[model samples]
Target: MNTSEYGKVAAHTLKLRVEGMDCGACALKIESALKRLPGVSDINVNFGTEMLALNHDAGRTSRQVIEDKIRNLGYTPRPAAAEIAIPIDTGRQEDRPWWQTRKSRLVLITAALLAVAFGVAWVAPSLSFYAYVAAALVGLVPIARRALAGAMSGTPFSIETLMSVAAAGAITIGAAEEAAVVIFLFAVGELLENVAAGRARAGIKALIGLVPRVAQIEQDGEIRQVPVEQLRVGDVAVVRPGDRVPSDGEIIEGLSELDEAPVTGESVPLSKTVGALVYAGSINGNGTLRISITKTAADNTIARIIHLVENAQASKAPTARFIDNFAAYYTPASMAAAVLIIVVPPLIFGADWETWIYRGLATLLIACPCALVISTPAAIASGLAAGARRVLLVKGGAALETLGKITAVAFDKTGTLTVGKPEVTDVAAIEGDEDDMLAKAAAVEQGSSHPLGLAIIAAARSRGLAIPQTFGGASAVPGKAVVARLRDGFVSVGSPRHASELNLLPDTLSDQVQKLEGEGKTVVIVATKDLALGLLALRDEPRPDAAAGIRDLKALGLQTIMLTGDNRRTGQAIANVLGLDVRAELLPDAKLDAIAQLKAHGPVAMVGDGINDAPALAASSVGIAMGGGTDVALETADAALLSNRVGGVAELVVLARATLSNIRQNIVIALGLKAIFLMTTLLGISSLWMAILADTGATVLVTANALRLLRVRPTTAASPGESA
Candidate 1:
């Protein structure tokens, strides 16, 4: 059945049949297809169901064209079950004159008139006056309409339209040629603003385009290519080399290296074997694997990212909200003021209309606030793109703004500051070499999925030590130890307390365990023949950059704190290295409360792994989750470190502050320049050319300055060995 069967508004629906998708990437590709279309306002796609839903503007773009785009992206096009018009505020271009329909067109016409006026002045100096007046009129059309409408709408006054009116008033009095120059310049400024805004949205569009389409499903014991959405939970799917994982699921069979860089910002490929959980959007390297779906297409990692970013863009920041309202009213007030400057002065002071009118035209040229309107949004967009490039995904301008003001940074101990997985840092043997002990440990723990056990096996493999055959009668005791047969004797391995409980405690092993524990490492004792032989100490070490990064935060005047589930000694060890002021331990809920306590001091930002730390991340003024940690953390945190590096926190803070500072500077320059010119025009001392210079010049300056962020590279490196 078609999407119309679902009773949605068909006019707003875009049905896209896509191709070349072998996983959840297809859903993302479809969503982007519809979203980028002219009239399509919103879109959602289900990879497992092979379906898409969209809300569109039926007038400006067609569902057919959108569907065609989906087909172009290599997907089969099918109508959705329903289509509906969403309440999106898209006003008609007809409200303003045709000339102002787009900034580019306005700029072109303004340029043409300026050229004509200059040519006239060059060829016949006498009629240059009329040529100038004509040029000013060309520029005035857009400014006059905008200002008048804003005034009638009773909106807050904007500086651009006001400047435009002032310049135009000056030209009308007796300097018509000069008035034209001012209007043309203002139009040029508006054009530049439009260009910068367009560039800002580019990176976001590129990100949305990363989702792939289609999946190769294994159904009825036969491998066949089918729509990703058609693969339900428990359905098995085959993932080939270089293919993106279709859904969040567990590997049922086979082994492969998965590149999770796109989704998690980690450049390393993770080894996935049977029973290992894999996330969607991660690239499957060489080797094929059969996976059993665990999460639906909509609930997958990439889908959550799309949903979060899209909604974030829709939400306006305080700065944008203020400007929007201010522009609405400011335009018309400026227009009215320009008119008064011309007529009121003549009537009240008994001066000639020609002279006063010229003054009014000058005022009009200085009134348009295009530069001011475009300044902050463009900067915000650039900043967001910069963050994205570094594998950091900041929700929107609001989040970035909050990031700049964060005074205290709270970190979750596990995953955020330390690797979530345990690793063997020290291995010792009482009566044998290290390799022999590790080989036995690996063989015994090979089948176990416990974090500590995995660490032992991984360490042995890294050292190229071959593990012995699987041990018989293997038994795992909860929170205690694992006992199994070894070549020499029965071997038991677990925490020191557990070894003592089993009467396998040894004197040398106890001394080593205490020594390691004093170094803040977790110790597991290995006992043989009812006697502990050695101690294996493992600790999730602090990220190499964590210490220096914390120091950087302090340099920026931000306080740093560390919170973890580790014991006080372990927590304090990490805290001391990083110079954190607060170190809390032993409970997840306590982390959340600690975040609250930090907030009492000032605005606090909680840096964490999105998974177990969601509560604390949610409680902070701003939440920054490490990329690759968890899907929930990515969604819950206001900002995500796609680089999955702790040092990004420091860079993010610095970048945010820079962006805010640049925007403020631009606003001051734009408004300050206009004010100076406005005063000159009222005294009949400002020429039309001067007004044009001020308006367009300010626009170029601000736009160029806003682009300064493009050069503001991330100060954090993706890897410890990489340069920042």
Candidate 2:
């Protein structure tokens, strides 16, 4: 549960799924109404997600009070639980017929009445005025009711209020037919906007629908279906071919190709054998497998992703916050200007009251800030969803906005640029054969879990060498060696430095160690108390896509550098391969200093495995954790790469910049259309219907433009002569 502290008082968070919010203005209206309550604070109403989250002092105000306030504001408030439930229909609501929904039904009814009024006018001209009046009144009733509700709930300048005023003013000036037409056009515009909004929300809805409602669990030696919520950690869940994995777990039985496109956005299906990890919401291919559940349904990967994206959408970007503040004052100011337009011309210039009043009504209709209010959040939500679809999880709009401004990227070496697992690369004989030396080393490190130890054991196994079966008394020396008794003598596997201290390293072997270390290989000595056996060389190689990922960042004109605790030779060797600069032998504090120095130039983004690089990640402008990293890393960083690809860093940048561009385009479209309509309304060149069209058309265009971000495919190419 999300909680907050209000001074010394603990405040409980309330998350509600708000329905009937037609535009961004409705979110603001609900927020305004809730803020007037006694103990509510930290109010956030996301129109894109239709979620209302707030903190309230439970001692002063209960959930019921907050919900009642939302109801009074003319919106239905339900607990957020309904939002996470898997819907029976995975398809989008917009796919259904437009007239099937309640909002669209109202629009259709208004249209039908308007057509009847027009038919009456053509057939009986004498009763045409009354017929038009009747049609206008029928539509005006609902709009006026909502307008009155908004005014009573603290939002006196809502879009509904403006529409109601415009419709009534037109009828007052004896233009009942035009009033009817304006009302009908407003309904049509709203219906179109609803469809567009539904389209924007379709991605999130699809994500919720990815997991099935029930999972097949094995109980008492019998397989039965159970609700996904009943799945517990360690329970065995059977997944057949073409079924979605019910929970995050490891495969304990069978092999199959799992399609993780819905969760991680990987295009290729991954082959999952025994002991392989699988996430919930992944579609299984032609195999039946039993998996040991590692995470509950509530804590599964899909649930976390959905939660993160919703919270991200709720967090406003810097631009969105600015626009919100601007709209707050802009609305009242526009209303005052409209009032002046209505009174000044008739009172001072002896102009016709009816004509001036008509112009004032048009101005009111044009003054709606719906398009401007939705501009930033709509693009941000789409950008987040798009990134999620690609497995680039940005935490919030601020982080997404900051990613675009990053001029330099700093990466931790181990587990980030490199594969993080060391492998035996070379073996040399100083006394006995190389195979004998490797087998002796493996005998000493048989039970060890160290990367270098595991590599030697694996190398010996791969070569089918026979390790001594009588080896015993194996013990580890911290940061140095693993010593064990083999056949009547003691054999040791340790670093070159440790061998030198024990006087067991031969001069030839010492020189060989230097050569291997210079090439970025870790040289370990395999020797006895009196004689040198041989040496084993191990190295953690760079990831396959490391070079290409670095090249992509350079192409985007950003500096790239590696910070590592490894020796200069090894760090530089990896850096040389990846085509990036290196800052070697840095302790944790030194890494922080390096990040600070990088930040002196511009905003620096730090990428790390998340556990050892927390300080640097926190110090940088935006920290991006590589996927499969520790939970601390994922939570500490502003964004995470669930795909675990180094190339995802470049893609994330491209997506952020694309989102910013989309936002700018939306703002221009929104304000530009409003400016044009505002001028035309004042000049008497635009009618009331056209003013409503301007508002509605701008909203639809902005929303549609924001949805284009969902289709963005980021590609990488390196330009010539770019460097860190």
Candidate 3:
């Protein structure tokens, strides 16, 4: 029967905060157990974050039942929507060293007992056997109980089972001292592993501390403190010099420099002016400002970032999935191999039963496969956490892996490659009175949501042109045109192609349009009924970092192309500035086709920021979204660059490659060490103590290797620990 079978109804997914997941195999075991339950469709367990993202039919399964199921498997589980409870013994332990942790203290007591037993064995030969027996009983009791618990839970092939069997086998052979030492070291290793996982998780949570609980908002003329969660949109916050901004808002008064390092990873401060955006965690410098909140505290950028990062941690990577699948089979194979070692050697070669059986016990302990199972997930979690700190967010490990290998990149012109804000440069009156044309056009665009329409209305207002107080709502379609009813006739403002199709274009204006388009200006034709009134040419400046960003990407060997709906001349003019290939006059579907065509060459990345481009982003091998853009783009893309600096593409690629390399290194180190230890144990060259120590050592080594990713920094960004 297929284990992947799901409920008939679509499953709702949620991330659950899980505890007592000791290893990658523990994650695999939990996944297997949950899948056997009714209504569960999928389960993604991230050992690094100790989280499980699962999907189940709500009617069949509930959160409380899911929690109960996890508890049944000898683990802890709760909805991730609530804060994870720390299992640390708080208060007294909080003031003491980490070594004083309850688990660590227990391990220390076990070690001290083992030490006294060994000392007595050397000093008093008569009491040596009794001391060793006491030590073995004390140490083996807890291990045996855990093994029994695992057996009762239907997980008989667990690490605890292997440890319990090995210790019992050693003691039965009169190796009581060796058995006691193995337990001491094994318990110590368990404590170290839990601590290591905690440290790995902390890297992702480091940003949580930056969010302020209270904000100072001025409700009349007097400033008062209010909880951030209580702050409402349109509420004004009065930020003094050297304070963190408490909400996603727009500066309505004053000016200052903002250190955006908390969000954008830019070390240098950015100047804040009236109308500029201020995020919840950004630090203000050297000025007082009044900011009108645009988003409440819960919906702010910082909060969204934290949410996405946690989602990323819960998301599994291809390598992790493969490793988990491999471990599932590897564990059983190892048990079979150990069984063969115990019986086959004594029967076939007439070897002594005691020696071969002892060898088999050591082999079982060495073949646990915990290190190999965790190799990829640990590195992937660290990668996701590090990317968040650098202000880049990858949707999952799969995207991170794909991002590193992107060979070709397609960019949307208006927003991605250039500042999407276009200023009105020329309004050529081809027919009718200029004032009437401007007035009618602005009045028609008064209720528009398009950038070009907004620009037209703003230009008209700046020139003191009369904008009608009441206007009909404008209707629009992507890549086509927008139209609204005017008092005189219908006013149309959109693509020149739309104007020509409507028979409102004049042949004489061809040369004028050609000249403006050649200068890289976006020309929008304004028409009414049967005649063209005027054409507005707007110039959207390329972003300051666009050229350098293009250069960086090119130098890194990614082919860059400008994919836009703009006509050929305008597209070419802009592409020429960035020295990129150009694809122009494309509709939304055409952009999707372009992505497919690009993917034929190799893995392609589509960078876009509009609803029209969502299909293209979803179709590409990897999609990169500008954080400031449409929600659809953000949702569709694989990764998000949260700042306008397109140079971040370089940073993202570098970080992805580094993370992949780190994962590879961890896998090699994990498997290579395991193989050598397993072989030694099978050949009777390794003892039970050596096998347990080697297995524990490999776990610590791989964990330490994966932790190196948290130190990964962008090449051109900032030095380690520097605010970038």
Best by lDDT: 2
TM-score of each: 0.73, 0.90, 0.79
The Cα error of candidate 3 at residue 190, in Å, is 1.9
Give model 1's TM-score versus the native structure.
0.73
Residue 44, candidate 3: Cα error in Å is 5.5
Tens-digit lDDT string for candidate 1 (1-724): 1235677444554544232221222343345445555656657553322335566766667766765565554345544322211111123222234345466576788889889889999999998888878787767776665555433333224333455555555554565655665566656655554454444444544554444557778767798887555557887888999888887789999999999877766678989899898887778999999999886666666666655554454444568557756754665677788889878867988988887776666666677665566556656756666666556678877888888888888888778788777889998888678888888877778788888889998999999998877556678877887878866777777888987777776676777778788778888887775566677889888887788788778878888888777778888866876778656564867777788888988889998877777787888999998855366556667998866788889888877887788778878887898898898878877777787666677777776776677567656423222111
RMSD of each: 9.3, 4.0, 7.3
**Clashing pairs in model 2, backbone N/Cα/C closer than 3 A:** none
lDDT of each: 0.69, 0.85, 0.78
Q: Give per-residue CA lDDT, model 3, range 1-724, as digits (tens).
A: 1223563546677677676575776776677667776888767777666678877877788767778777766566755543311212224322245586655766987888888998998999888867877887887776677667556655677777888888888888777777887888888877777777777877555776666778899877889999788899899998889889887899999989999888876788989899998887899999999999998876777777776776787677888878877876887798899899999988999999899888888888887777887788788878888888878888988999888788988899988888879878888887877777777778777878777778888899899987754345777756877777866667877788888888877887666887888888878888877888888888887888888888878877889998999888889988988889999999988888888888998999888774456778889998888855224434668888877578878778877877888888987888788788888877778888888976787888888888788887775533222211
Off by over 4 Å in 2: 1-14, 55-68, 82-98, 254-257, 265-276, 346-350, 428-437, 462-470, 473-492, 497-512, 527-534, 717-724
1-724 per-residue lDDT for model 2 (tens digits): 3444654657887877776675777788888788888888999888777778888988899999888777776667766664333422323334466667657877888999999998999999998999999999998888888888788878898888999888888888988988898888878777877777777777777787888889999999999999998899999999999999998899999999999988766779989899999988999999999999998888788888777787888888999889999998998898999999999999999999999999998888889899999899889988998888777889999999999899999999999999899989899987868898889888898878787889999999999999885455598888888889988589888888888898888898888888888889888888887766888889998888899999999988999999999999999988887899999999989999999999999989999987778788889999999865235534769999877779989989988888998999999999999899989888889988888877888888898898898888775644221110
Off by over 4 Å in 3: 1-16, 20-22, 33-45, 52-97, 100-102, 218-222, 273-275, 423-538, 629-634, 716-724
